[model samples]
Target: MTVTVADCERVQTSWFQLRSQVLGSGSWEDDGLTWANGDLMFPRVIDPAALARGVERARSEGASIVGAWLGLDVDPRPLAAAGFKKGWAPWWMAGPIDLGLPADPRVELRKDAPGADGRPPRAWFAAARQGGQAAGGAWAHLVDDLAGVFDVEVPEPFQRRGLGTGLMQAVCAAAASAGARQVVLNSTPAGYALYRRCGLQRIGTGITWWLHLPS
Candidate 1:
């Protein structure tokens, strides 16, 4: 199945909502913008009007810094007019899980189990271990048939050792095991090639806007 940019955005929003719930933060929508307050304040905007409202809301909430995810179709002139600067541009990627990718023998994959309290897990985490030490990790949130992958990281010391591919493969395996039809993630420049090797394609480019509000 082909995933469009809209699908990618919806999956991204779902990931943010799941993160907010897990962190005990708040997520809401107002004036066509989706807002989330967590380690960082994020307002997903679709247009200039919503962008303006998000800026005001962030400032009123005393947010020292606000980040906005804008689809590539969004006009940048408005963001510049509002004093928001361009942040990193990440590719929105989605694809079927390539279970054929070979997992690194040195990296053992672990998935989070249900807590002792027995509350069903809202999100699944996949961590890669090398010689019983933490090598890399990532999180996957399932919303219906779509799974959103977040924070796929491999430390500098762990780089160039295929830990990232192992993590991606592990994530895909977990998502597939949980019945997800597709996996999606925003890929940074550094991780772009790895994700491609894992079978994801760049469906769209997403813009992240940043603004520092007065204290």
Candidate 2:
């Protein structure tokens, strides 16, 4: 199964839920914090006033907007012209097989077997030994249609090892177990080819937008 344009709205909404609950708390719950992980962290229905207020709170508390991401359905130029810089434009891709091993994923990290109900739990794998120590890992999530990834860096000295591939396989297996259709992520140029080699493709471009608060 592939992700469609209609999925954009859902993806954006889901991102909000994740950013909210994961970073701190959300408006959905009454007990959320006064200082929130606002629209800046991820693509959100931007309310300028709410955002300004949030930023002020963060600054007063000695916090800053670390990063921002949002999935788009229309051309991103309009957004960029509005005062945001292009961070990344990754394709949201999907594959036919969600479970089972890829043709040759190589090496094992930790395997989270699929749940009894026919869903695989999220998993990760890595390989890149120091003196035979693992260097890097790749992983994915299984949150409904919002399934996605996590990437980690291997210490500089451990570069060029296949730890990255192992993590890719780990997430794929987990997605398969979870019965999810697609996995999405924001990619930098360096890893684009590796993802393609792993059977992941670019479907739609994702962009991040930011506006400097008038200081």
Winning candidate number (TM-score): 1
Q: Give the per-residue lDDT of model 1 (tens digit) for 62-157.
A: 668877777666666766877778999878899985547866675555556676798555467777777678888888777777888889988888
Angstrom error at residue 146, model 2 = 5.6
Regions of candidate 2 where Cα sits further than 4 Å from its true position: 5-45, 60-62, 71-86, 97-130, 211-215
Candidate 2 achieves a global lDDT of 0.53
| Cand. 2 TM to true fold | 0.64
Question: Which candidate wins on lDDT?
Answer: 1
Q: What C-alpha lDDT do the candidate models reach, one value each?
A: 0.74, 0.53
lDDT of 2 by residue, 129-199 (tens): 44656566655555574556655455667656655655666666656665666666545677777667666
Error of 1 at 211 (Å): 0.9
Q: Lowest lDDT 10-mer window, candidate 2?
A: 27-36
lDDT of 1 at 20: 69
